[model samples]
Target: MALCSKIIEHDDTGRYLTINQIYTEPFPSAAASGKLRVEDNNGIVWILSYRVKSGGTRVFSGDWPRFVQNYKVKAGNTIVIGMNGTGSTDHKIEVM
Candidate 1:
């Protein structure tokens, strides 16, 4: 789906990730208020919930700490989130 965003310092420290508004724009209305299944490149999976705040959406989950720990993602990294298929409920994550 070509959805991608940079990992900011806040993401690493706050244990949460922000989904850019450009990416969220195409999400189904319900998606903005629900959980999404995000899978990393190594097949690790996390269920992240979306929150609408300050006119934008951010995604976070209880497993965020684990994900960060396992992935070793740092600030300034690029994280890409893409749907597995058309209308699929699962999204894949790529770190670069």
Candidate 2:
């Protein structure tokens, strides 16, 4: 599955990346709250924890700061999240 969303202010300072509702809808129930591996454009993998919150689903973890810094992500940037076939571990992300 492939998903895309724009970076927001909170994402840059809160140490959490929000997942859009459209993308979250197709996720398995268990994915609502658990660890997930997200790879960046450079193929660096980050294990982030996700959960459904009042606002939406957010991906976060201790490595969030490093992930953002490494990618030089900023508010207004667009990010694409790609997952290989269902149940696949090859999840990747790209910034544009």
C-alpha RMSD values across all candidates: 3.2, 3.4
Worst 10 residues of 1 by lDDT: 23-32
lDDT tens readout by residue for model 2, 1-96: 565555556545457776645534544532654766776655567776666666665555556677778867778777666674433255666677
lDDT of 2: 0.62
As for candidate 1, its clashing pairs are none
TM-score of 1: 0.72
Candidate 1 per-residue C-alpha lDDT over 7-95 given as tens digits, one digit per residue, 9 for 90 to 100: 65754535677664553454454255576677776676776665555656555556666776777777877777777663324677677
Instruction: Quote model 2's TM-score.
Output: 0.69
Show model 1 residue runs off by greater than 4 Å. Answer: 29-33, 85-89
